[model samples]
Target chain A: MKSNLELLTIETIAEGFRNEDFKPSEVMEAFLENIKVKSELNAYIDTYEDDAVSKAAEFDKLFKEGREDLPILSGIPISLKDIFLVKDKICTCGSKMLSNYVSNYDSTVKKRLDDQGVIILGKTNMDEFAMGSSTETSYFGPTLNPWDHERVPGGSSGGSAASVAGRLAVASIGTDTGGSIRQPASFCGIVGLKPTYGRVSRYGMVAFSSSLDQAGPLTHNVRDSAILLDTLSGFDNRDTTSLKLAPTKCYEALKKNDFSPSEFKIGIPYDLLREGLDSEIDQSFNLLVAQLEKMGFKIIDVSLPSSKYAVAIYYIIAPSEASSNLSRYDGIRYGFNEESTPETLEEFYVKNRSAGFGEEVKRRIMLGTYALSSGYYDAYYLKAIKVKRMMQKDFNEAFKKVDCILTPTSPELPFKLGEKKDNPLSMYLSDILTIPANLAELPSISIPFSISSSNLPIGLQLTSNKLCEDTLLKVSSILEREVGFKSKT
Target chain B: MVEKKEVLKISKLSRLLIEENKIDSFLKNFSEIIEYINLLDQADTTEIGKDEEIVEYSFRDDSEIEKLEVEDVVKNSAKVENNFFAVTKVIDEE
Candidate 1:
């Protein structure tokens, strides 16, 4: 009596496709129908119906022709965060500024996804230019938390994480700048990884905060994230910041499991857990630690002395970088244009931007410009970078004694959608536990820990040193098994 | 509290127009955020040196990048003329 496609993981669906249990087109139809009925969730800004069907049909034909060596992601439908370019597709980056704009070239990430035969279901919504923590700043409207239908899904990757958690897409890719990906993943009770900063290329991915932005996957499980990471990561000459390290076999690395819990040391930063955290989350974290200790991991007290200043440093540095990165949106090139003819060039710039951008985007841009202004550059911007280095040094020192660090992914659970929208400071504080990873350029993952009394999902975050995703994934996968939290469709 | 004039100055510098009615409320929130981030002033960064390894220079063969088509380039513009984007006249006609 099950007319709908089964809620399956990306790995399960790929195996099903290989075995011909269900065609890709059939799965795509079911997902598209689900998205239509659940439109109230606001998880997707657009879904490619005709294109997805045709692409699925092409994959089915290839599979039928006995192409046993098909790419791992072939026919797997996924969603993009709207920041990455997909040639000829509208990439709004969740802003009115680029509402009608189409990309002429595919971003490096899109090209890699295409090469592996991954079909993009559509471009998902996000915070306008990836700015806000709740996705409330998106010009299209906020993406609701699927779990409660009234709470936020967390952002600027809210739509990306929500799409996967709601079973609208098998997996989704989102960019993280100061916990955009990990925080939303935690809120939605899905697996979200922000790979080390340069682990993925940024070419043609709409720039937010250049130094901190790294695109990663959102999935229901760590294995799917590892699968997507293996496909999405590599060196691309187009992005100068792209790392030169050899691509990892993350999926295979998950199987190694060479280390035991007895040999592992987990770091708990007392300063991060001191205050401003929900008691429910603190309880969940304590339970997780107890479970780990039962499995034999020795918990060590670690100090990230500079972490208390991370939020203050992040607000200054990210916005300062954003202000510079966003200057390319002048109407004379591409994106929203002023309707009235301006008499002066300055008037043209002001009119187009003022009309195109939302309130938060403009606010950040102004704040950034002030911070980087001539007189205050040394006091605000430069000082922030110095503190950023100290934050990184703290992590480098902590890793010496601990295999990985554990913290609450967010200070609180998924909150009501409009609760903190009006208070920008409160929205910014939501990322407190997750921002240190971005500041330190380390790989971090958020996995479900337990369920709240209010029936919402709670998450625990794990962090490892630079380029140490294998350790993070290994630890998270073990935790995922012990927790065994089920995701509701 | 920040002066009203300073808000206007930053807005102009950012090339964003703040509506007259919204400026008062906007400045209030802006001041609060500014005050919050000012907590960094308490951190003693005296021992931290300037970020020397910040930039990593990677050079490639000097070559022209493939340019986007004129049609695609001008598609989102409000006005275009003869394969060029139309913009406000920069020079004055005396």
Candidate 2:
């Protein structure tokens, strides 16, 4: 047996299980042991030990009985970010307000995964309310980067990315409101996908910004991401925003075993390279482009000028909607309520809310409220919306000339925890490259490309037009094979 | 320019009470954020439309639907009395 199961890809795990070389229960036990040993990473909020064990036992029984109804992920263990509701489990969303709140129903994604026979490993930690770029805002404390314990695992989905990188679980589900999934995935040296908004059902997901919030898989490679997306994507009557189109059978596309790099037209955004990106990242990105060119893919220089305003516009629009969506957690319904003797009903409302929310959450709510307020609405929120429309148009035009757009996921690798805590603006800049995908409602993936001189992993981002995740995965699979940076669990 | 006083006002509206000690730091940080956002005001938006069109949709009539009894609504509350949600009195007589 390997010293750590970190190097186990989904393909390898599935092959092993199919050949009867190892049982699902044994794999689950190995992950549990690794999680315990690497407890300092703080990757999980809750582990479903009995649930995982029972599921694994059921899969083992089915295997012995020669039943074949189970899907490809019949015995795979997966972690869920704290935001996605798992019935009867604590879905805290990394906030003290919902710390004791047990979900009464499984989220649509969770239900679909369960139907596929994927065992629920646990719930990973996250930033409170998915508000921060780094998981440092988590009420339970931040999840550490698996590569370098001192640096952050890129965040809101920090714990999910860290757990997968650290090999605590095979793959995890993460919610990306802005760059929550990709940014952390970049920092942790794993693959993360933010499926186009409406690509996955948001039925039981706690809303941050309904427009920007999307759920996708964080896996070890593009194939696993495609498989997870196959299980997770579909139309649900519960989420009105879910696309009415038939659910994409992404896994079938990957299973076809096609490896023609000449078929891919990789779009390179020249503007991103000339901007505020780190020099090392720029060099690594050029090296990646050189490798792809050698593989016969045409590297076309495309321009998305409006992308320069993504972070500024995202902050405004996301917060504006977040302020409205979060208004439901007024302490009386589903969150923490303060025991205060107020002189008026209004005072009761004030005191409870004042006590419940954390500093970062409060800061965002204030900024959002002011942006949407009567006098300032047109100046801030509405203006941001217009810019968002333009940004989407820019992407729509860019996709016409290329198969996929590629860029560095983060300008630089993960910094040490607490390094950017005091400077909120600088922290917001970390998601500069990723926010455009969300704004455009496009599918994007981040895969680890190289390690920095400091041994921190760097991520390369590949994005495709809406509903074209197949193309994105195909390109990513080719890159993964060429780059060959497998997890060293 | 956003001032400390303005920050306090927004805090009150948002129901976030920043302590007196931390108000200055919060104000400074907020000012910097606002300054960064203000750069967008310089963009040429002369062709942009100001008025947004609101779309209205028709829904099935609910006039014939029976309303839920007050008892049903208050049944899940931890404490309820006389078809009302019970709680500590929030207002005091002057």
Candidate 3:
């Protein structure tokens, strides 16, 4: 019964809450129990067992009192990536630099989840400052994949993905800068969505690559992604980048099932998959497409030509922005070694950062500083921006011909731990497929649909034009129904 | 290829200290990434506009709202005196 409760989806749990099958406190106990048993998976950096239990008990009391005005997500259990500030709780960003730093206020998403009375299980682990492709760089240590202890869960949201995949948390919220969310979700065989660039507010979330970073849900299924996105979406005066688009109705569309697959033309960039993709994933993708074709949908062969340069463009632009955004850890304000007395301010900053940051974080900071340096700025940073515009134009042209594009989320299956750690270049290629959507500021989702022969999970992705998450979710739900994938991993 | 001195210079500009022993491996990794990003030069960007993409946000009304306590703001500082952050003295006194 405890294992079964851990596997319940957001929708089912919400229904069970209304039906009085079990109280919110019971759900909390079951999940905390699973987390305790699977403690070695390292999915969580900190588990708020006492706090979560108390909150769940309070909600259960409210439920028993017959409160009718409670929110639909009031009793849902979820985990948050450590990047968001939770007001007095430590917001580490998986780096030693701010490992013990406490946030004074809540991030917008954190406030939203709390306002809805959702029980936050704990803060999950991640790459240091969300810099690396593997969770190995985290100061707290790597989060092992629950499916196979020797393999990675893909990162920097590896712990977020693992928490949901391991059933440690019913769902999780993770930030994506160049496929940080989807890549891990794919590797872990779960649903991960990176909402349109400005769809969600980033007021209190730590900045990685400001232009590319956007948070979304990693869930067990498509409907759950929609449910979480709806709660997290809206315009915020605090976040100037927040879009003024209409609030998402993804969950509503999912329940209504109002979309027909026949009305949409799905595009597959066969040329992009001609190389670099694993044979099994390539075959699985083709089979899924054929299945969609059999369901009365028209398939088109479309290519975003400039997408070939996604990695190169992303590397230049992300690091350039990151170098500037991460300039705040000067140790005078707040950070590791804030208490240290150094000979000079410069020495203080250099010393704290050198000791605090891992190799990957320093590597990025150096690369970014070099790219944005006076002489080389125009050659690298400016050129990458113009090329990013070209990539956007390519997507614009493709979207005119196709309703949405479909592709494999990752080029390969879950890799063994340390398989690509030594090779930074190859690690960057892990997000090659998921990076284009981020570059073009488009909305996309990765859906886990099949398990490979070796018992690893594989995911297929869908990308829709910006502010079209309704259609994206609708079509994905249809695909989800047709594929009938559940109990992933 | 990035040389040893260049890596040190950039690290200085970024305010990061790089010990001498790790400089070799750091330079190796940094140069490879720099080389990888050079592939951007292959794109024909002559007609492309280099103008920065501007995202226009409406100016919000300036209204007083609840604010953080001075103590909350400076609580993380190593030295706090009279509700302010105290850092290392930068100017040399005569």
Candidate 4:
């Protein structure tokens, strides 16, 4: 049995409401009860139970009045990762620096969700400043994996993925920078999509490597992901980077019956799978490739040689951007400020930041600062940017021959908590495969392919060229139908 | 190679305070990372340009500035008095 009402997919919940099988208030209460029972997961940093109920009640009234004007996501409960600002709520961004910080305005995404009548379940946990891949670096404490509490549910967007995987929330919004969403979604056995950069506005998301960050959804299935993406995507003048392309009616895209495998070509990167991948994952990925071939899709071998350097390039670029982006937190604008008087302005800036940020965040900030420093800029940061360009060029070349690239989202399965805490390199290597998509500004999705014999979740990643989210979703939906993994209760 | 002193300097540049006791461990780990990054320097980057299109512009706006009241800003802090945030003194004044 499902543990709570909030765990149901948006489609399922909407269908039930339409059938009058259960009231919207009943579903809201079920989610509140589930939150109480699953406190150990730390999936939520804060839940607006009263607000959610009121919204659900409002939706119920709309149903009673037979209002056809209701939005597509009426009464659905969606979790927001702490990084996204929800007006008047504490939007801590999972950092000690902003632990008590509350937002006075909603992010464009939040306003859109609210306008569409999606109920805000709560704010989910994340890596401190969305830096780590394992969610272990969250200031609020690591979110336990629901499948096995000892292991992490991938990170940066780990809590959002875990909440969806554990059925705590039907769907969630997570920010992806260097694989924050897809990696965690892979580890947690769910669907996570990072749309083309600028497809979603970044107006009120607390910045972390601003150029690379894009918010996407984590959901149980591809259809739900497409539905959420439809609402989430579109241009907003507030975010200069927001895309100005025509709005895609993604829900309508889902209904098209032309999902024949013969129409698609799949690309597999042989080198990426050969070196860093685990044996089980390789076997599973090959098996999925074979399954796709049997289903009538053409498979082709593709090369993206520069992608080998993506992890190194991403680490430098992301941190460099993060260093600059996070500079505003020097105790003056929105975070903790040290009270002591300093002889110089520089010393005051140093003291406030030194006291405010946590260890992992500080480490990245320093790594970033050094890369961007005067003498080293050409040697480190600038070189990474060049590599980033080549990585994107490699993808551009590869996409000329194939509709999508398929690979294991993560090379290895989830590791035990604290296993790689002492070794930052090992942790960084975990996100190697997924970072290239972010660097290329392409769209990718991670869908649970098969569960290990050990019962841990393993994910298959499907990546399409820039703004080709439709094909990615169509392919993922076909695979989801074939693989058939049940959602965890 | 990144030296121990360099790590300390980078730490200072980034506004991070490394306790004297943790310096040894920090240096050992940081040097390993720097060594790994050195691998990128050896790549045949002859074709790679110094000015690449991938470099993103900074997301700050210099055109429109919104001035705020000092009172409106400090009113939300948990510990504030005299239009300033109260905290433990961090440095000695000259």
What RMSD value applies to candidate 2? 3.1
In candidate 3, stretches whose alpha carbon ends up further than 4 angstroms from where it belongs are A1-3, A338-340
> Which scores higher on DockQ, 3 or 4?
3
lDDT of each: 0.89, 0.84, 0.89, 0.85
- lDDT of candidate 4 over B1-94, digit per residue (tens): 6787778888877767887897887777677776777767755677877765743333555575445467767755656778887654656878
Model 4 has an lDDT value of 0.85
User: What shift in Å separates residue A127 of candidate 4 from its native position after superposition?
Assistant: 0.5
Worst 10 residues of 3 chain A by lDDT: A480-489
Residue lDDT tens for model 3, A1-489:
434777898888877777788789999999999999999999998878899999999988888887888888888899999998998899899998888789999999998888888899999999999987778889999999877889999999999999999999999999999999998998888899999999999989999998899999999989999989999999887888899766688888789876687899999987678899999998888899999999978899997778889999999888888899889987767888845678988888888888888888888888889999989989998999999999899888889998889999999899888897778988998889999999999999998888899988898899999899988988888887888467654
Backbone clashes in model 4, listed as residue pairs = A154-A184
Task: Judging by DockQ against the true structure, name the best candidate.
Answer: 3
Mark the regions of model 1 whose C-alpha exceeds 4 Å error after superposition: A1-6, B64-67
By DockQ thresholds, what CAPRI class is model 4?
Answer: acceptable
Worst 10 residues of 2 chain A by lDDT: A1-10
lDDT of 1 by residue, B44-82 (tens): 889898855466635556786767877887776778898
Which pairs clash (backbone N, Cα, C closer than 3 Å) in model 1?
A: none
Model 2 misplacement above 4 A: A1-6, B50-94
lDDT of 4 by residue, A1-489 (tens): 334466678888887777777778888888778778888999998899889989889888888777777776888888999999886788888887888787866888899888888999999999999999888898899999999999998799989998888777889999999999999999999999999999998988999987799999999999999998999898776787887766567778778857778989999999777787888988888888998899998999999888888778887888899998988886765677666777676777787788778778888888888888889999898788777787788899899999999999999999999998988888988998899999999999999989898898999899999999999898888888887487656
Candidate 2 residues A102-155, lDDT tens each? 676789999999888889889999999999877999989999998988989989
